[model samples]
Target: METTIYHYALCVSLTLMLFFSYRFFFGRLPDSELYRPYRQSRRLMGVALLELSANYMVHFFITPRAVCPTIAILMNLCTYWLSVWLFGSAMMLLLDREWVSRRRFVRHIVGWVAYCLITLVLWFLLPSRVSLTALPIVLAIVFMAYAVRVARKVFLTFRRTIRRLDDYYSDDGAAYIRWMSVFTYWAVFFGAGQGVFTFVPDRYVFVWIISAIPFYTYLYESYSNYLLLYEKATDILDKSNDADAADEEQQTAQNPSQSVADNVNCELNARPQLVMSHDQEVALERGIKEWIDKEGYTVGGLNIADVARATTTNRTYLSAYINTHYQMTFREWVNMLRLDYAKRLMRDNPELPVAEVARQAGYLSLSYFTKTFKDAEGVTPGKWCR
Candidate 1:
């Protein structure tokens, strides 16, 4: 009865794996250049899942008692290593594309090859039963160590990237980094669970099946989130491109000679703008300040383009104006406004929670808001209020 139950669970897990693997390979993946790395990672994950399912099927269903234990052990070891290789490749591409070059990829391949060759030679020397039973435990321990190391490295890199950004709420690059961090954490958790189950194959087969349901469910949900994020990123890019094109056309229509000069200056000098007369500059600055004051746009994910659109100005001109008048980049200027607003909110409603104050101040993340507040004011929001 126990064997029957385990067999049924394996069948169900295998079916689900195959279905998702098919979806991953043939599903409507995002076509935007921004999603290229994400798409590649999904493909690698699909291949790994397929190999893992095959490994389980062979171990449970195909390996008969008459079959040589050495052959079964070797096959399982190969599949285990292959799955790890595929996952590691996917993560490397996702977290650090620069590190996924041909040289690094080849190095990884060589390392895996050497490990497998050494293990196989050892397997032949050991008794078949010992090799079958003990080798998995050794491999599981090594894999768990690798997973923990990789997870820590990925998390630190992600945290550093976020800290370096002035306005993470509006930066898609920051969002991608955060998402990769979540993926790394999820993969490590599930991979560790699977590794632990490998040690107690007799007692944990049913538990493994139950755990796999949530594991694959989370995997699918993350894939959906990736799709949604891709769509949003592409939409933002399209709008930015359209806005730039429209701005150029309007400028050319209004002042053909000045526009031509500006284009030439932009190509040669890297920062070209029609010299704004004092009156024009003041008017633009006033318009921006009034719009921000009235609309509270600074409370959330404000960008130069958004402000430019609100003020009926070009983004380039608006950015330059902010830089010249405020002595800061657009991001810094927005954060300055947000920080001031948050301080006032805290002072007026002292009873409100710091998290609520952060939200009202347009911060998507409370931890980030606190860090920014401390950087600017030398005290946390809670401390400042007191």
Candidate 2:
């Protein structure tokens, strides 16, 4: 009797989370900010949660059938498949790209996922003991192969996204990579727990679902916050792949741009390999110095795109030049300038409050400024002030 009540409680809680969390990413985005990859991720997560709720309903609420050996295995398989297919794949988009195409994303990840699912589904129809026995071996291989897949997909996306963030704005979502890393490790633990509980006694399954409610809540909140903060950068991340992104994307990487990149494969550090000629490079460098001398970096939320116009270059060329010349990302370069000026302010105006110093240095967030200052100088601004 108590067990039945407990099962009911668990199902109700999971259902509630599924219902309320919809608004996290599904709220109306502006027409201009309706980024495809971001929307795709939100849709994938919504589907994943729906799948999770269904599996949990059977696994927890319908405990008698759930405990049957075949049902238990099937339920676990469903959970595992959803984890890798929908949620994992959602997080893996736009990797290795200043911009990417939809076909490239499908080729990079969805193809392999489809292959694995096909193999698993086909092997399941055979009731042979050999097929059953070999299932664990196949899963081990899948896990190993998918490890490489995740590295290629998720890690590359992180690298490109964070670098792009660094190339553009200091206060954007570069720091969210750390949160994503945490979420990923937690996901592995949660997925493993779901599998393990299928074999354990039934009541403990509640623990995974109960904990999962909060986990999904955190995931939704973090991702939504990232979308809000870095709306512009995320919008442009997949612009080359989106059809509706005006006429330029129609003449996109698939034709001229992709061909140029593939043929050259040139060292990114080599300036001569760039499309820009010697005089253009000299003029751009001079223009950059003039912008710096004018204290353009002191503006709040200054980004590489803003300076790109000043220097008469696109952000691609501007980012490349900053990376090669300063040997740092645009964010790092900008922060260095900001910090040098901040140090001078602290030294000269020792009586000034830390918040005043941060604001004068063009830092909008005091905590972020303090963290950045501490990271670079091994001391907080307050200590540096003293």
Candidate 3:
């Protein structure tokens, strides 16, 4: 009866988390921001669902079983994967920041290495026996150590970022870091308290009940973050609408010369040049062409955030803009540009090797470029070059 209740609670918490995760990446995106995090989030969601399913099955139905090796292995794999996901998220957040530096990257690498080492040790130490008793003991110690390290780094980074924030910002969601910290603590606690039932079973049940509280809290916090982001989007749209109206009125009242300026601004603010209402993707394509021809910029070794910064925008905003304008995500947009450039360059330089052409056309990964080009152009770079 008690185990069933715990399973129910876990399921509810995971379900809520999944819902909010979807809402965060999909539901709230404007046309401009649709492709970036949304694309990545979709991939992450698959991983997350697998992880959650494995975790639940092992913890509920097969906690002491040796028969279900599949679920057991999945649980072990997912434990590592969860940490990787968290680390990746933190890296993405930091990479998105304007102030990301070499030192920060170094620290991030160090933190990731430490996490990997700890996870490997834990995996080795994990008992071959299927009882919850030995497993939790190992999990608790390992999680506590890893959680402590992560907590220190995350809190320090969060504090630094918060201090750099403006005194009054329309959008402030730094509070999520606090909730994440609490969740980390709870994860460690739950794993640590797994064996306490031997001494006092009822007390252990209460500990589980306490642990469920934080899981619920974490899930709710995720939902709240998504809600806040959605609200912020609505506010921006409202403000933009008001500004558009005010501009129209001023344009109506203006003389001919001033009206020309208004017209230019209007064109700039018009629906992004695409089939859809507005698209960031089209704008990115146009921007890439302009940079190559006019400014001599290169996309080699470039990530999405780098492209965003080059365009004087945030990645989310730029991603939405590209999606709205060109109907493609940053990844698609970048590959398209690279492949296009490679084709033109290869045609112009017939003597050049396909790999050289790819490199010259700003592709960091030759194999990746070849694969993407084949998908897009229906021919391999080498074959095309030939």
Candidate 4:
């Protein structure tokens, strides 16, 4: 009895902490499309939290193992399913594109929640033998089917979103997407823990609730950090979809001569796929090389737009030119340039602080620099310098 009381107390405390932390930190973000989804996310999360608190409170009144074992297990299982369903639905809205209406999408989510609630309530009110035997079978079928669908959606959507973020920007967009990926896997792990509660002894419930604190705290942190840059992410999503092929026409590039007779050897098959002239390519190649020679990649927060301005071209041309000539995305090209430069800087100025080395190498985040360096060279920057 005391263990159960303690478990609910911890749950309420954890939920309140997660609930208030986001509001305190990101409460002032002005309303926008991305924020609307995040707000909807928060709303559904609030409902889940309320359900958790209430369900835990109910455990104080009746022990599932002792009396009406079927209804009790039904109650516990329903609470777990509601939490997962609500949270999954929240993530769906949070990752939405502007191509759809948020208001309508949210209505659909809430309606789904209502449907799940009704189904679970019906199961709870069923006879004991049926609830015991049928619930597990039904849940197993539903879980298997739902898991497959979720795997496909996450793979496709995340691949597109991450690809678009990579193709468009050289910032935290993919980082945000990667964190969401982690949270999704974490949700799977969290949901799986419920199986233990459904089948095992009750004392282990405390262990699962303890795990919930950090797992959902990460969820809250990622959502808040995402809101910090959700506009950039949403901009990329709004402009493209997974099914759409990239347009070859240069929308942002300055008007350049279309004469293809100049004969520049970029050697990319995708070269002919674009509208760029040979002369324009020649000028861009020369200008981009000069920019690199001048250490333009060393600029803090360097992005494709900055490179576009420096080369007197535009983003579309710069991106395509890099993709064609270098055979890497702009971010990869810049990172390679910066990493090579940082190694040279380390060789020449071994006394430089690792942080200074990272700063001079165009990495705004030292941790990001260290990780990238280690991933590339098999050693930390400092260790590599030594």
Q: TM-score ranking from best to worst?
A: 2, 4, 1, 3
TM-score of 2: 0.72
Q: By TM-score, is 1 or 3 better? A: 1
Ranking by lDDT: 1, 4, 2, 3
Model 4: per-residue lDDT, tens digit, 1-386?
A: 24665457565655665565446344676676546766766777767666766775565554554555455555655566556656666666656533236685576457546646765776768786777777755654454355445544655567656665565555445775677678777777666446444554455545555666777667667767887677766665565432122222343132233323112322331233355678988899899989989999898766666687799885666777788788887777888899999999999999999999998898888988998899899999988877
RMSD of 3: 19.8
**Higher-ranked by lDDT: 3 or 4:** 4
- The 0-to-1 C-alpha lDDT of every candidate, in the order given, reads 0.68, 0.64, 0.49, 0.65
lDDT of 2: 0.64
Q: What does the lDDT read for residue 216 in candidate 3?
A: 41
Model 1: per-residue Cα lDDT over 1-386, one tens digit each: 26677677778888888888888788897577877877887898899889888876885677431255445445555565666667767766655546557786687678767767877787788887877778766766766675666566666655644433322224333554465666667667766555565444454556766667667766767776767765554454445446657767887897788788878975673445656778877778788878877855544655556777678776767766766778875666777888888888878899999998888877777887888899999998889999
For 1-386, candidate 2 gives per-residue lDDT tens digits of 24664576667767765774476346665555346666666676777777677666765657644445444554455456545556566666423322335666466457556645765675677666745456544554555455445534565567656765676675644664556666666666665444454444455555544677777877777677767654545544444224123223322443577435633552342222235669878988999999889878888877676787787765666767888888998888988998998999989989989998888887888898899999999999998877
| Backbone clashes in model 2 | 0
Decide which is better by TM-score, 1 or 4.
4
Ten residues in sequence with the least summed lDDT for candidate 4:
261-270
Worst 10 residues of 2 by lDDT: 240-249
In angstroms, give how far residue 300 of model 1 lies from its true place.
5.0
Q: Mind sharing the TM-score for model 1? A: 0.60
The numbered model that scores best in TM-score is: 2
- Assess every candidate by TM-score: 0.60, 0.72, 0.38, 0.70
Residues 1-386, model 3: lDDT tens digits = 25566567656655654564555445544455433443443344444444554555555555522344333433443354354444334333431332335675467557656755664565567665633345444544554465455455555555543322211111222332344455445543443233232124421443443454555446446535644454443343334345435544544564446556556754664322212123544666666566547423244645444454466543434544656557765556556666677778888888988778767777655776677788887989778777
